[model samples]
Target: MLLAILLPFLSFMVRGKILTGIVCLILQITLIGWLPAAIWAVLSLNNARAERRNDKLIRAMKENGR
Candidate 1:
């Protein structure tokens, strides 16, 4: 919720991808392009979440000696 509001800033903090955040911020500065920026932020966030989940699953498997 709050992430969606401060996405241009939080995107870098959460994803550690400064370029992506910067691009989104630039897009957002163009009022007509703000929607695309928001959509990109959401998609990027989702990708980051999936990557984290996959990493956790791999770590659990390794810990279990799988």
Candidate 2:
């Protein structure tokens, strides 16, 4: 929840997605576009999490000789 609030900054700092973060921040500055910016940031975070999970699962399966 806190991360969502700071996503515009963290997106580049933590996620290495500088362009995305910049765009989101710009959108947020427009007032009316804040919701879309938040939504985009959340979706990006979700996709990153899912990709990490899948990578971990694949590694575990390989280790188990699957």
Candidate 3:
């Protein structure tokens, strides 16, 4: 979260979205676009977390024959 807020473009790169990271870097290059880029990074992080959690749950359910 800190990375997302402090360096929005870097966050995207860390997540392995090179194209998106580049776009974010471009957006973050301007002061006016910084806030939106940060918000986008944070939201993307949250969604990634949720997807991971859902994947874990699905795996557990499959193991239990559910």
Candidate 4:
């Protein structure tokens, strides 16, 4: 959804019509042909953030105890 709106901007950044066309095609394929992988990427990022937060909290607790 967001990618559709940003497509023109991305195309402008790349500055090559052929490359832009190929990139847009890949993005479209990602949105349709490979949605699960995108979903997993988001999920994995969220999990990594959660793990980092937990590690920070645990370290803080240990430091306070000392």
Best prediction by lDDT: 3
In candidate 4, which residue ranges exceed 4 Å CA deviation?
1-33
- Minimum summed lDDT over a 10-residue window in model 4 is located at 3-12
Name the lDDT value of residue 35 in candidate 2.
72
Sort by TM-score, top down from the best:
3, 2, 1, 4
User: Each prediction's TM-score against the native?
Assistant: 0.73, 0.80, 0.97, 0.51
lDDT of each: 0.73, 0.73, 0.98, 0.52
Mind giving the per-residue lDDT tens digits that candidate 1 earns over 1-66? 357555554665566777767777878888877777777777767777899999999999999995
Residue-wise lDDT of candidate 4 within 1-66, one digit each (tens)? 233244532432333445544554565465563454344334544665699999999999999999
For model 3 the TM-score comes to 0.97
Estimate, for each residue in 6-51, the C-alpha lDDT of model 3 and write its tens digit: 9999999999999999999999999999999999999999999999
Q: lDDT score, residue 18, model 2?
A: 74
TM-score of 4: 0.51
Error of 2 at 24 (Å): 1.2
Q: Which segments of candidate 3 are over 4 A away from where they belong?
A: none
lDDT of 4 at 35: 51
Clashes of 3: 0
Clashes of each: 0, 0, 0, 0
